[model samples]
Every structure is written in C-alpha cells, then in structure tokens.
Target: MGNLCAGASPATDETIASADPVERALAIAKRDLAKGAGKWQELYSYDRSKLLGSGAYAQVVKATRKGTQKSYATKIIKKGQYDKSVVIKEIAISNILSEHPNCTKLIEVYEDKANYYLVMELVSGGMMFDRIVKKGHYSEKEAAEAMAVLLSFVSFMHAKGIIDRDLKPDNILLSDDTDSAIIKIIDFGTGEFMKEGQTLSAGIGTAQYMAPEVFKGKYDQRADIWSLGVIMYILLVGFMPFGGKNDAAIEKAVLRGKYALEGEEWDEVSDEAKDMVRSMLQSDPDKRATLQQLQAHPWFAAAASASESAAKGTRMVSRLRGFLASTRLKRLAMLVVASNFKAEEVDQLRELFVTADTNKNNLVDFNELRTALSKLGRAVDETELRRLFDAADMDGSGELDYREFVAALVGQDVVERCTTARHGAFKDMDADGDGYLTPEEVLKMMPPGSTLEEAQEMVKAADKDGDGRLDLNELEILLKN
Candidate 1:
C-alpha cells in the first residue's frame, strides 16, 4: 500500500469530479490484495490487556514472549469485524519487512476462533507529531533524519513492486523515547503490489496528506511522496500544510496544493528543505520530484558530514577486517547477539546501514558496500573486500541484511554489550542444558529446513577445545570474536 493520498472524504466543491477519495483509494489497495493469498501457520500469543493503540477492528498491545526479555507489540484483529483477506496480506508484508531496521519486524502470527494476533517488534516512542509538539522545537537535522527513514522505506518498497498506499505520520512510529529512536513504519492496511507502469486511479489515504492526483483518483507511488511532504511541512512549520474546519475543507485545501512556506515558521528552515517539500507537494504528479531526485536532493545530502564519514568509515573497515577473520561460528553467534543489543544502541548503527544501502533494497550487496566504502574513503583491496563480503553474508544470501551488518560492526563497546547478552542466548539455544551446546541444540534457532550438517559446520568453526559441543565460555568467545 504505497500510495498515501489526500483526504477522508470526496470533494463536493464545484471544481472536483470524484465523489469519494477514501473509497477509491481502498478499492485500489484491496483490489491488489485480492490478487494474492497467504496463510500464517505459526503459533503466537500475547497479553491483550495492555492496549497500545486501537481502532474499530483491531487493537495493538504490549506483549512478552516466554523465556525472553524482549518487548513486543501484538495486533489483535477481531474476527467478523474485518476481512480475512486483508489480514493475510498484512501478515505477509510484515514477514517480508521483518529485517528492515525502519520497518516493524513481524515475529509471529496466530489465530483463534474469535481473533487473529500478529506479534511484532514494539515501538515504544510516541507518535511523530506528539513528540515534536512536546519537544517544542523541531531542528532541521532531526527532520532530515526522519525524512531519510521514510525515503528509505518508500524506496525499498518501490524496489520490490509494493505500494504503501497509506503513508502518514500516524503510521510512522519511533522505537523508543530517546532522541535517536529508530523509525518504525507500521500499518499496511491499504498497501498493494504494483507492476511496472501500473497506476492506481483512486485517492485512498488520510484527508490532509493525500496528493492532488489521489483526489482525482489517477496517481502512482508519488502520492506517498506528497504525504511525506505534508509531514515535512508540519515538522518545520509547526502546523499542518492544509488546515480546514473539517475533512471536506482539508480535502479542498490539499487539492489546491497551497501551503505556507514564507512565513516566520519557514524563516528558520533551509531553502533546500523548502524546495524538497515544494517539489513533493506539487499538484501535478509529473512535476513532482522523482524518487531518484528526492534521494539525491541537497537537503538530505547536506546532512552527511564528510569529515565524520571518513572517520567512521576508517573504523568500520577495520572492524570488517576483524569480522571477516573470525570463525564462522563466531559470526553466527554474533547474529543472536545482534538481537540482544539494546534498541537505542542499534539506532546508533542505523545511519550507517541506511547510508550503505544506496539502492534501498534493504540490502547491501558487495558492489553497494564497496561503493559506499570508497565514497567514504575507506576503500580496500578487491580480494579482502570479497573476504569481508563473504564473511558478513550469513545466510549465504550474497548480501548483508541489517542484522548481519550490525554483527559485523563490532567495536570494543559493542563487543562488551554482546558479551553481557550472550549468556541468555546461549542458555536459550542450549535447550538440553547439559552445560554444553550440541549442533542439534543450535539447529532450533537456524532458518527453517537448516540441515544437521550446516549446524555442525557452525559448531566446528569455533570448536577450539576440539570437542563436538560448546560450553558457555565458547559461546562467549563465539559472540565476542
């Protein structure tokens, strides 16, 4: 559901032709969903009493999985209230995006006769709007950081032929209360997958954020870009771009494509920021900034400090060399340890991941990593580069997903953090608890269909004592190495 377009209602204005914008938008997204089907067979459970957010059909609540300290959010969908078809697609999308640092990670899905529950990574920070107003000042750098997350999300989804169909501040949440909280984009209620050259002819999104073309019901992914423009405007100006007494008035104002950009509120924002916002809010979809143009915009580019990049790149490359040199088992152990890193610590690493994912596929291929490294002046020999790439490609997926990237970014503090967290992971994986872990014990944690031999390979990589099993000390070494 990539298209986030305008208004909750259709315009009754003499100038408008469409009678229902929201319905038109939902029809496009649901029509797309009708073409695909899926079922979530995994079992999941959560406490339904601690509600985080709720609506007519579903309620999200805080949840805790047995034997783990991780906090999660579970969206419980009431039976007979919403179509099962929509539920399937939402779960499928969650599974697809579980690895992205910016998107919610769907942990499990289960259903009972009365409801369906989708448990996922919990976002603890308040809404983006609530945070800004409470903080009382929205800095340009902070706005840029948020924009970067949204742009990356949109770009990644577009690369996969998916449309968010609904992109607004309400659907975007933060991972925590800290200033560096990671962006967690949630709610794919109106998402759809599009083919090349496809167009959605309905405006299916919140009233104020909808693009003008969305109101006319003839638009593409760019409508989400427009919605982001609305968020950006509010971030800098301290008010919505198109304000009105009601949904109808907001719809009319959005259709007019007029917003304040020269008042006192706009005085502190950079011209480049204003330019990007203006381009995104363009009434003519064709006149809007292309995704490539948006990614390359000077507003975002200026946020990157060349000096900082060079310094960080130097340290990261050195870490890469060490990571590549470590045993395969250590690398595998680091993946589990990566999950144990506090969300705030991971948020600090996110900027590096986003910058390296130049193509925005939520992946950093060998070439992309090389190019990114070179750009940061941390170039290395081709042979060594291949070694590092091969080392970080944990699933042999030929690329480093975000978790793998985080594992490979180990420095002293990261190592200490992982060392402290390694015990819980070891105890969990050592299911038999004989004071040693066998390949059989670890296989439960591997991907589905992982072979006995693959698990053996992992254990052998760090079997320094020459035994076929590992003790907690070995697990610590495996994670810390």
Candidate 2:
C-alpha cells in the first residue's frame, strides 16, 4: 500500500518508507500531534505574552505549550461576562469537530476561578470575509473548493446530529498560507444537537441570512442549509439575497419568504452553481438541500478536482494568480460589481425604489429613490444619490422601474412572493363578499385565542381611510406588516 503518512508534517520531506502504510501513517500523525491545555487554567500555564485580539466577551492570545512549545490560540471567556450555556455549547461543538481534518482542531478546554479557556489550532491567516472583501470575489474554482471543504465539515456535523447555527464567511479561518484554509465553524453559541425525529423552535442566527422558518419559530438542522445558501450566494454574487429598507422591512421580507435569482446579474454563473444555491436557499426547510446533496453537486465535483491538483503544485502563487485571472474569475467579478452595496439598509432602499417606480424602468427618479433611502437611515446628496442609482441601474435607463428595482433590491422569487402574499392576504381577509374588509369582519377572521384588543388594534392599523374599513391598498400594507 502507498504510504498514507507521506505528507503528515510541514517539516518532513520524505514519504513513509515503512511496509505497513496504515501503521506508519498513524505513527506519523501521533508524532506530529501537539496537544495543548483543554481547560481554563491552561492560560497561565503557558506564556501569556502574545495578545492577538479581543472581542465583547472573549480574548484570543497566542501561546505556546510548555512541554512541546507548539503554537496555539487560547480563547479566554469570562464566566459571568457571557452566557455560560453558550460558552459551554461552543466548547462542546468544537470538541466534537476536533478530529476532522477540514475543521479547526480544539486542543483543549479548561476552567479557572472566573474564566473558561479554549485552546485551539492557531490559524495564522485571517478570515475568509476579509479575503473576499480585499479580493472582491474569488474565482469559481476557488469558491467551489472552499465551499466543498465547508460542506464536508458541515456534512460530518449533520451526520453526528450537530447543527452549526452560525455559518458565515467570518467564521471560516485560513491557515498560515492562504492556499489551504479550514472551514472553522466557530461561535456555536446557538448550535443545536437534534436527535432523529426531534425539532427546535428558536429564532437564532444573523438577520440577512436567516430563513423564513427561523422567524416562524420552527426550525431544525435544515436551518443550517438555509444559512449555507446565503453564504454561497455571497460567495458568488458578493451580496445577500434578502434585505429591506429597515429592520422592520427586512423582518417582513424574511417572514414572508421573499428572495430569488434571475436576470443579468446571474447570467454568467454556471447553471450548476445557480442550482446549488437555489437548492440550499429554498423557502421551505424540507426542500432545502441536505449536506449530502450539496456534496454531490456538479460544482463541488469540479472544485474538488481543481483543489487536489492545486495542492500538488509547488508554485502556489503562480497557480492561484492564473486561476484568479481566468474567464470564470472575470465573470464572478462582474457579478460582484453588479451586486455591490452596504447591506440590509441598501436592500430596503432597493425594495422601496422598485415599489415606487411601478413601471419596468431601469432608473428611479430622485424623489422615489429618496423615499426608499429615507426608510433605511440614509439621506443622500444628489451626486452621492446618483452614484447609488448608477450602481443598481444595470440597463442605464436613467430611471428605475419595478423589474429593475426588484432585481436590484432582492432576488426575483422574493419579489414575486411578496406581491403574491400582499394580494393573497388582502383577498383572504375580505370576508363580507364586499370589495373590502370592515373593522368588524377583520376582527371575526382573527383566531379564537387572539385577543379582542389585538383585533381592534389590527383594524385600526389597517383602516388607512380612518373609516373603519380596509381598502385593497390598506389591506396589502397590513398583510405586509
């Protein structure tokens, strides 16, 4: 058998010459194994000289093991400073992933008098988020390869009944060299361990990437798949699929299950890649792609081959630079430029602009754009405003209409759903066979347990004309809310 231990250490240049490849490989791994303190006091037990960074509740310090002098990152979390349960959950998840090659290894975890310390592999390179921002967007091959690694780790976790609630670009850390990075799914404070036939009802995770089911308080491991979809979208398009004018708007959009992909922005991306993203981002959790399904995607297969070949090459810089300059990279760059914007607030502005434009024009006038931007905490000057319009107005029409606006704000599917829901809810609530719903009729449609006061409030809110009845426009607004 070929020597399995051939490339076990950074220092070693020779392949294992032993007759027993498996035994030799095991011995090689054991020899290179550098364990650190798995508990809290391991902080003082090592050199506390190198302080790397600090966060709201934890501080990461670069430390060396006493006996082996192996480098490690010691994350110290104060006992009362953060949620103890959350800290423990993160530790548990890290421990479970410790043995996976694609995962960040947790050396050890321990507790001292007032703090908990988690010793983990020290990834010298920074976060994938930082890399993407600096590099704009990655080549298809690079993005696919990185995604495959992450999917592998996530697949392993799912098989073990652990769901990584937090899946974002920031959580993925690179090694000393950028060529090989580990998808460190850190910050498992919101992670859930679900057994067969079990489900959870917790609305946790970042707002922009959260699924509709998450807001409805009905979620499971499939929630992770939704998050993966958002991540993949960002990886390809360099922006999120759902976001609205303000927090309320974003919440509404999410709750209503609005988001999609169509038009010129996605034209260059491969059909396989688009399919993979759509599969993951499905509004229904049951329809979202599972980890195994993702692994079998054509995109992953292509990426895996490229990654394996890249790993064997000696000139990493040249190889990566060539990949970055390829046609695929150029196409991805176009997508990135097409989707560039701040975040949720921009998403909201796009929504409002799309709504006000009404017609399918490519440019929104100053008045309409301002109205949208105002709802999202931004008031812009004419020049700055023009720049914003130019960024999203892909067709150069000098004014934006519904299709262009929706395309700029959220994906197409979301816009369709929002339109449908707004109309559907209004139709459903109009129960008296009249053209509209009166305050009394609206109250009657309320579920049995819904309080009388709550129903009255809904009527009051929906009665735009102050006549105790809701017209179609007023009813649509109420349903959106």
Candidate 3:
C-alpha cells in the first residue's frame, strides 16, 4: 500500500487529536455508514454504530461477541460485490491462517443472507505505511527487526499453502505497544492457495511493489518476495525505489529495468542491507531469495540468533520439537519442496504429458518421452532417458507413468536451476564483509574500463522494472549479454 491513505484526514481534527491515525481513519471510515456504501443490513446483525472502515471492495466493522462485550473486526464481503472469487478466496485464506501468530488472527466467520463476514482481531496501532512516512526510513537494525517479524509471518502463510499476493506496508499493521510492536499482516483479499505445481495466471497486487514476472501474468508465491523487497526498500528509504509519475511510465520503466541508488541519501545504509534488498527484488522469481535464505541473512542474523537462543531451555526445546511436529511445520516442509519447481516448466510439462499419453494407458514409453523432451530441446540418449523414466517411476514399474512423471518433475532441482546458481553468485557478489553488493562490488564484477555511468546503466538494465535493485536473473542476464 502507498501513502495515498496517509494524511487523507486532517491531523488536528479535535475528534481524533489524541487518537492515532488508525483510530482517526476508523472514525472517518464510519462516516460511510450514512452513504450506505455497502449492503450491510442483510449480512450483519448490528447497525451503523459498529462500522469501522470502508474500502473499495470491503468494509470492516466492530462486532461484539454474541454474548460478551469483547469486540473484533468483522470484514463484510457481499457475494456479488467487486470480485466474488477474490473475496471468497480472501475469506478462505484468512480462515486457514487464523492460527498463525504473525498473521492477523481471524476470530469467527459466518454467512447470512448472501454476504460473508469474517471476524478478526483489531490492532489499535496505525498502518505500517504511516510509520514509514512518519519515521522517514529506518536504520538497518530497525529494518531488520521489522523484516524478521514479517518474514516469520510470510513463512507461516506460505506454510499454510497461502500466498499473500498483496504484501505492502499498508497491509502490515503495527501494534499499539511501540517497544515490542508485533507486525500483523492483514488483507488477504488478493491471496491464493498454491497447490503442487500451481501457477497463478492473473496479475494482481499494487504495481510498484509487484514482481516483474507478475506483469507477464504468470507468477507464484515468489511474487511475495518481490513485494517484500519493495517493503524493505521503503523501510530503508522514505520513498518507493520504483516511483514514477504515472502507472504507464512506471510500467515502462519497470519492464525496461530502469533504477538507481546513488548520492548522499544511500550513503549511511550498509552494503549488505542493500544487497538483501536487491536480491529480494529480483525480476525473476526463479532467482529471488527463499524465505529460509532471507532468514539466514546477516541483516536478520540477530533476530535468528535471538529466536534460537530463546529455544535453548528444556521446556523451550520440548515446545520447539512439538512445533516442528505440528501440521503447519509438515505443510511448510512440503511447500519448501514444491516451491522449487518453476511454474512455466510445470505448465509445459503438464501439457506435454497430456499430449503424449494419448493411449490412455497412464504410461509413456521411452520413444514417446524422448520425442516430447526433444520438442523442448532436451533430447537425451536411451540410457539417460531410461534413468529419467526410472527416477519418475516411483513405483519401480519400468514404464513412465503420467502421475509419477509429473510428480518427479515438480521437484525444485528439476524445474529450475536459477536458485542453484544464485547461491554461488550471491557469495561472489558480496565482496565486502557487509552482507550486500554495492555499486562498487557490482562494478568490480564487470569488465575493465566500464565507467560509473556504464555500471549504473548496467544496474538499471538488470533491474528490469526500475525497482532500484537487481535479482540474480537480471544480474546474470546483464552480465551474459
């Protein structure tokens, strides 16, 4: 989310002078009740007094527990509203993620007379977008702290088979307590479930924070990584790294990969911090850093260390083991395995298997398989092809079964090699003790006589969406070309 929501209301309004921006915004939001912004009468049992906030597609209201005064945020979605599929998806995703600590907890859900109402915890703190604007970029330590909390939350969501397609500063909420502010990611209205080999074809999310591949209409959870990078950059810099005057210019600049970070503004920030942002903002999801990899980053090392240290005692260890054994952990492990495969490759393989297995015998002979691979420029000899068949034939049945073949190919290593190479490149790119690659480090990787402008040009070229950072794909592509 951008700062468009910021200062929309006057700061000195007496009604909200003592209240934070969130409270003020909630109050302003209640004004919509007079306009009858949504068809709330049918779905909700209460009247306008409980209304909270109203946005383009949904409205959040204060709903009291059936028998108690305890209040929760109830997000009401009319069935025939803005986008039905997206609304239902958001509801389902919120329900699925209700149990995770980092994610906003959903209290209860009910449908009445054609509308869906999702009850969730209401954090009193203002939006993260407000915090970034007010604070004007955080220090590396502050950024890392916020990121650690966000990463943990995102990791949990991914574990639950949910991809928060829209991850931005506004979607993230800061708790009222400033010292130990918990980052709760809300607004799952654009989220989607990712099954084995699932690839989202629709383009979604705020443009500036979106991944480059999203512009092409084919993306996965790695899209979240792109958004994460954007958020990280904003946390480090007061403005968006990919800002433009209009959507068209921004889109063109992004596709052409135009971006830069020079001058005194970026001097105080460490190279390692920049490098992490660069890697996360990679244009290609294939080359983006994994959540686990992000967690291991030095920027996050402190938090990681603290988390590890916190689990040292016997009671903590027992709890840790139990957590690892929980359904969430098991699902996360499965997601880690599934996330490795590229969406494009899986889609292609799906089509190939469907076409080649015309006999309906559920298996493809060696010749048929070889022919299919050949079309994709992956021709293999009889022995290698047989090995491929055997590897895919988990049942040990010599023949290459369709289901087994698809399953085998869906593994991370099989569908993509970008991640494998990115690890080596990241180490080489980070020449300094700092965890990131500076323009100087990036220049060092180039040929001799490459002017600063040339280096800057290359960086911009590789950025592939003007997001001021480079991912492994852009780096490799720029260097290779």
Of the candidates shown, which would achieve the greatest lDDT relative to the real structure? 1
Q: What is the TM-score of each candidate against the true structure?
A: 0.54, 0.53, 0.52
**lDDT per residue (tens digit) for residues 213-304 in model 3:** 88888888888988898898888766787877887677666676555555434644567777898889777678889999998887665433
By lDDT, the candidates rank as 1, 3, 2
The lDDT per prediction is: 0.73, 0.60, 0.61
Highest TM-score scorer: 1
Candidate 3: give the clashing pairs. 254-465, 257-464, 257-465, 272-435, 272-436
Model 1 scores what on Cα lDDT?
0.73
Regions more than 4 Å wrong, model 2: 1-54, 66-69, 81-85, 180-182, 244-248, 263-265, 301-481
Is candidate 1 or 3 superior in TM-score? 1
lDDT of 2 by residue, 194-259 (tens): 776777777677787777787788778888888888888877656668888776677688777666
C-alpha lDDT of residue 431 in model 2: 68
By TM-score, rank the candidates, best first. Answer: 1, 2, 3
Residue 129 local lDDT, model 3: 87
Which stretches of candidate 3 lie above 4 Å from their native place?
1-52, 82-86, 302-481
